[model samples]
Target: MRDASAVITKKLYEEDAYRTEFDAVLVSVRRKEDSVLDVVLDQTCFFPEEGGQCPDRGELGGLSVLDVQIEGNEIHHYLEAPKDALPEAGAGIHGKIDWPFRFSNMQQHSGEHLFSGTVHRRYGFENVGFHLSPSEVTLDFDGVIPEQDIPELEREVNAAIWSNIPSVVRMTQREDREGLTYRSKIDLEGEVRIVTFPGIDSCACCAPHVARTGEIGICKVVSMIRWKGGVRVSILCGKRALEHFQKLHGIVVQTANDLSTSMENIFPQVVKLKNERQQLLARLKDASLKELQYAAKEIASDEEHALLFSSGAELPAVRKVVNALCAEHPGYCGVFVGNDEEGYSFVIGSRQLDCAGLGRQLQETLGSKGGGRPEMIQGSVARKREEIEGAIFSLTRP
Candidate 1:
């Protein structure tokens, strides 16, 4: 019921301006079935999600642009339709972005380059991976870096920031860049946009970047893990770095208050508390085992079979008690307990009796599942405790 032939113009480089209001003529419009109006401007400043950096978000003429994508050379702006009717094709429209969000992304992305470049330059480590997300930017390096060297690397990157080096964006012909030095993990064979972090890093990229290295503000390494024959470094930059510090400071304060200790001594206090709790739990487990042993003596049946059912004992404790009881008695001893979210678990064993046949019969009768050696079997069932008991009795009574 709507026209499909509108024209729009796209402005390719709006990120260069820290803040700008722009106007463009509608180049074309295509309506998808989901009610999203795919409108294209002859030119646009909205950067599409490309080269790992997410797209810029903003509004066009008061309509929310939910997503932006590049198909071929045209940048498609997906926006919600007005209640009355869609905007006509060929109409001029204004576009703007949330500058703060865009600026934060620029800071984090540029900071990642400096970090990666410094690591590579100092240790001969290759950057094997990179991810730029809304929350943080992460880089993976090819080898383990010593803990003592991390501070030095951070200092090196911040030193570049202090230098106020110009972040150059250059377009060079493929042949003209023959001897130029840059870090490229993949082969690039065409005309490319090179982003250079002055003396720190130079790489071919198409994403929008800040004007100067100092604009990156700061870079912080949060964690490092060995991965894929290499080390993965998790990092936060600029605003995110500041946010991480504030969050950790708040936690330290809250922990200190809860433990009735000063912030300066919280670390040692927490370590002491953890050690004390572990010792107490170990003693409790030993006491529980003694009680279970005494309980087993009273419940041991004179008949050939003994059955024990408990509701809340942990799985490991139940298993320990069941195995000990079966070893002491020659007849069948089965233990049943409720598992966390997993309905019920049964452990059955016998010293002289064949438990494998009984275990299979129980599984088939109760519609349950599990298996073990010829002398013992353990598994879970979906039925209630009463239903499981009824099924087990039916299988074992004969």
Candidate 2:
């Protein structure tokens, strides 16, 4: 095996991003796993995996390329083919990239560049980080950009997309790089590859992009969240954005039909349904609380302990029951909800005994998970009612 460090992979994608079919020499081949082989090519059109973007997926020598990575100057193509299935080193091989996939990626990358450039130009926020996956693209910024202002950015990006601005890459040498302006994460020296979209964006990028902005189709900012000190925003472009909008509209339409209201009235209809749900829950809680309290009272004043289980009772109602029983009961008082088969959620209280001690006993003995103050403890345990009763009664009062 020759040192791949000396094997320079002529990146044909840089020459023409649209070029899908190409032939290259198999410079080096190594076995990474029993089922996987890593092969390096001399000159290839496949783009290796880089930060902010995934590697191009395609076939190399008729075998599916599992992954592509750039190490030193060699572009490694990972394939699931056995060594016996592949040709020997120095053999000429032919492969073609997944064109639609590559085009979509190009659209997304170019769209991101345009949007980031617009934000930098208008709001002066530098793009601090980026991640591009098959399903989504998230761009991080060094400063905050409110949700309300993102519409303007989207409009600007879409306008640029529609303008069909030509995409050009300027290979600037270190000596000629002086006085030239561009957006980059690092202070680039040496020969820098600068991809420019006319007046919109000029940034140091090594990925292959579309020939024109119009090829991006459209740009849409889907969501944003506050991050470290700035914000991370998710965006969709081209067919992806259109598909998203289509899916969302379908959901809205279905929701409106289910609610028996027009799309425009869905919000009010949902609010109405929510109010009805709240009223029903309030009534349920009132009934549950009264029933639980009545059960508590049924425990004679002479009784030292009380344990009540109400299957449909809410936690708040159970807690109230525990509180009422503890006011009189001298021993442990607890109310549990749920059946023996499904386990139970419980609120246990004691006036004279230590509930925290019981909590630990429950946790250690039955592997129950929860804790609270000494006076009260709340947790869930899967033990049957009989087992739980035994565990609680066997422990001496702490």
Candidate 3:
């Protein structure tokens, strides 16, 4: 609304954000590519991508508007079309904004303001960064937030939403502002657009937001990760939050039913299953190691090298057998576990030959991956067992 006479495109979005359609005349048109057109409108309801909020997408003159961007005073609307079908400059056109997309973005953006404002007031932390995508929204803060206070922060955020506070927007002159406190990432010049959430936040922004906090439905902080010198918090708001909860609930219900227990007992049951699996794996590994060691003693090792293969054995068990064989045979010892189609987990050792060089040789020739010391090496290869055995036996040839 700041001196519409000075700007070319009349941004109808600034007047009424809820307005989804508008009639506008084309100010200019240029064909950017064979099927792509850049059309500027005299007035538009589609909001351009600004202030970290994504562009509003919809149809303009029956052509799909892929993106909307601001270049100085003009809002460039990127459209798809054939050259013959494009509207000429000065021609009137209909502009439609996708309401659902706009509403979802508004919910998340406004929800973030509420949360950021509350955290800033309570913890003295600044919101340094924000990103909103279709799948996730993340806010980066300038200071660490205590983990114990997160629940309290969530409670406060939900409380502010439940209060159904109205968000106010004002355009102020740059010089008229004095001794006024606000959150801004940069020092904006000219006319400044200030968005205020009463008793919660006042920040400079150029994006459309929900008129009331209650429209955001619910705001849930999903994750927090240590970032730079501060913390990054991930959140889901409105419909996204509801969908996330439902998906998780479905998984919990399925798991509880499968275990023949209630949801409350799912955690203990999963932990018990995990512990049982670990104990079984340990016993199986011990038996495999003993069996491999006994088989290594039984092999006729008059030659300088020996190789053995086991089915479905772990890498650790293979390494144990290789170490024992190398201690006894003194030349080259190799153990391969798993079938040829799935590749083999291999361990090679030698007190005499260089196992690292052999591993490298196999890697270069057979496209295998792994490495270790000269005396002992571990890796995997997709080559057939016969090919690997032939290569090992060739080293023992007279």
Q: Best TM-score goes to which candidate?
A: 3
Error of 3 at 152 (Å): 1.1
In candidate 2, where is summed lDDT lowest over 10 consecutive residues? Answer: 389-398
Q: Which parts of model 1 are misplaced by more than 4 Å? A: 1-15, 82-85, 124-129, 140-147, 170-180, 184-192, 226-231, 262-274, 300-305, 309-332, 336-346, 349-369, 372-376, 380-398
lDDT for model 2 comes to 0.89
Tell me how many clashing residue pairs each candidate has. Answer: 18, 0, 0
Superposed by TM-score, candidate 2 places the C-alpha of residue 17 at a distance from the truth, in angstroms, of 0.7
Greater lDDT among 2 and 3 belongs to 2
* Model 2: residue 96 alpha-carbon error in angstroms: 1.3
Top candidate on lDDT is 2
Residues 1-398, model 1: lDDT tens digits = 12323323344563363654678777777675456788888778787777777778888878877788877667888887654547766898899876787888888888888888888788888887788878757788888888778888888888987787888888878897899988777878877778898778998877777788778788888988787877888887778888999999999989889999999999899899999998887886676556666778787456566666655455688778878788777777777766435677778888888888877787777777888887888887877777776776666677
Q: What local distance difference test score does each model get?
A: 0.77, 0.89, 0.86
Ranking by TM-score: 3, 2, 1
lDDT of 2 by residue, 1-398 (tens): 56777999999999899999999888988888877889998899899988579999999888999999999788999998965775678889999999999999998899999999999999899998988888889999999997789888899899999999999997889887678778999887787899999899999999999998999999999999998899998999998888899999999999999998999999999999999999997887787778888888888998788888776688877887788888888899999877889999999999798899889888999999899999999999998999888887777534
TM-score of structure candidate 3:
0.86
- What's the best-to-worst order under lDDT? 2, 3, 1
